[model samples]
Target: MNEQIHEKLKEIKQSFRLMMNGVASHSMREKWVAYKINWGVPIPDLQKMAAEYGKDYELAIELWKEEIRECQVLATLIMPAEKMDEDLVEVWMERLRTQEMAEMLAFNLLQHLDFAPALAYKWIASDRDMYQLCGYQLLARLFARGMEPNERGINEFLDQAHTTLEGNNLPLKHAAYNCVLSFCELGDEFDVIAQKALADLNIL
Candidate 1:
């Protein structure tokens, strides 16, 4: 990395140290076992840092590689969604080790990508827990933004969600439920599918 980027990373680390809360970090670590490095900086603080740093894809990539949870969150915030693509998204998804990271990537980064809808479908169909959660979360974000999938896409998603719900994984089931809820809000056309999915999952 260049001197500028190196200095910026240093500055961010310094800021993290200054703002870090030991009690909160311990609490967060207890909740998120996947986060080995928890600085315990709040989201608002991270947002302030992101605003100061602006969008720097390169810097964001570097920050994302760090083990620190807050750094990873900042990375998503600093990354320009327009600069995101399938390959990078795949790489980042593979790095996600916690539901918190999955949700951050889904809502803060993945949801803003041009390929979000397509990618959401792909991830939701995956057998991996984190990938599926990210996919469902992304779908919910898209739904909140008033984006609706076609009939075929809807069917495919609901089918996958049903399968996930049938499984014994609580996290995946939660994601599937959230995805179904988002779909149900789209229109009456999806009501039957949603109800069927909920009923099949014993959530009705």
Candidate 2:
């Protein structure tokens, strides 16, 4: 049954891949999809697949990220109804240890409200460079979604965000921008927090 599910998913992946044929890599595919397709369309396909599999979110997550951006959109859509349990979240987090794919997975996992902050926090502290970025990205997504961001946690994340900027890649900066963007949208409620974030970080 699982094999059947995977086969069906592969067929879809291949079909989409063909639609973007000559896209040599995931990044190219992302750019093409971002420019050409409406993200909203992928959800119905994802939801249909999710329901067909009886809420096997883990499988859906795995299949979704097999192609990165398309997978990320699908994973985000899959989150509202069927959230993965803690154990499966851990499995997903473990996959984030590999820098090559972790960023996309971490981004997707944060969309699912069931994920524990500890999972994201742990990866933020990890020695692996990109996983650290993934960690920050997850936290940013959570903060952006208004899921977490209590004082102490937000303060801790602020400190990490500062440290992150001192590191490399655009991921950390993007994460901070996303968090502040969310904070700004919350109006005066997050003014003090946003002020603290600006004060503590060199982020532009």
Candidate 3:
């Protein structure tokens, strides 16, 4: 089973390399490659592949390490988001541990699943660059997805966002601004909470 997964990953890597010749490095070709490959594929394909291997996460983790950047990105799509083990997710998270990417993933996952607040809170308070963005991204996605924002959660995230803005770090500031903008699209229920949060932060 490991051999089969390894071979399959090799084929994917070869195909990805062939596809990359036309992709400009200045653009986000890796993400595009991952999106194209995973889109429209049945989730069962991943399940079947994992099942054949006895659902060995160690094998999956090893396979993720074998690939280059785009391959790792593509590998994440094969793991069922809901069934992802805590340890395996942590392992994969470490592999893609950029602040922006971490934040981006928190937002992306919220679109498909409920907020794992404990997992998210670690990133929210992280002093690292991308990890902090992960927190704001989670908050923005919660509002953007219209998922009944918890008042306490909103207040907590706003506190973090305000801190981010005060840092004078351009990347964090931009992420915060985008998060605020995304939050604005929510109607009155969230608006009322956001208005109060912002006032408390003196962002109003």
Candidate 4:
């Protein structure tokens, strides 16, 4: 890393240390978060920090490589969407280790990307749980924003969501459920379609 990024890393880690919560960190561990270093910094605090740091692609990439939960979350918040090309996104996806990271990236970063729809669709088709969770979460954000997918997209989404909801992964099911709910929010037509699609799963 360059001197400037190294200095910034030191500063960010120091800030994370100052805001750390043992209780939150313990809870996350109990839930199997598995981050090598988790400061237990809350999302609101991370957002404040991101605003202070502003967007710097290099800094975000370095932060993400830290293996610290707070830094990764901060990376998602402060990353420049335009600079996060497909290859970079795949690299990050390969590094994803937990559902928390998936949700954090989906909520704070991927949702804003111009190619998020295609990305979400691609991930949902993956057999990996984390990928599916991220996909569903990203789709939920898009749905909440009232974005409409074309017929093929809707079909693909419904198939993946139904498969996920029917599976045993609670996190993926919940994420898929949220997507369905937000998809319903698009309109009554979407509502009917989603309801019919996942009715057997007992979620609308």
TM-score of each: 0.95, 0.62, 0.70, 0.96
* Stretches of candidate 4 exceeding 4 Å from the true structure: none
What CA RMSD would you report for each candidate?
1.3, 5.7, 6.1, 1.1
lDDT of 3: 0.57
The candidates, ranked best first by lDDT, are: 4, 1, 3, 2
Q: Is candidate 2 or candidate 3 better by TM-score?
A: 3
Q: Model 4, range 22-115, lDDT digits (tens) per residue?
A: 9999999999989999988888988998999999999999999888999899999889999999999999998899999999999999999999
* Cα lDDT listed for each candidate: 0.86, 0.56, 0.57, 0.91
- Give the winner by TM-score: 4
Question: Model 2 shows how many backbone clashes?
Answer: 1
Candidate 2, residues 1-204, lDDT tens digits: the string is: 377667866675665554443433445445443323322324345556546545445556665445344454455445433456766655555544333244445554455555547767776677766556667667666766666467776677666666766566665566656655665565566766666667746443
List of clashing residue pairs for candidate 3: 99-130, 99-131, 103-134
lDDT of 1 by residue, 1-204 (tens): 888988989898888988998898888767755676788888898999899889999999989988889989999999999998888887787788888888899888988888889888998998788888899999989987879888799789878888888889888888888878888888887777788655845674
Q: What shift in Å separates residue 173 of candidate 1 from its native position after superposition?
A: 0.9
Candidate 4: give the clashing pairs.
none
Q: Which residue ranges in model 2 land beyond 4 Å of their true spot?
A: 1-3, 23-83, 96-109, 200-204
Q: Give the candidate number with the greatest lDDT.
A: 4
Task: Give the range of the ten consecutive residues with the poorest summed lDDT in model 4.
Answer: 195-204
Residue 87, model 3: lDDT of 70
Window of ten residues with lowest summed lDDT in model 2: 32-41
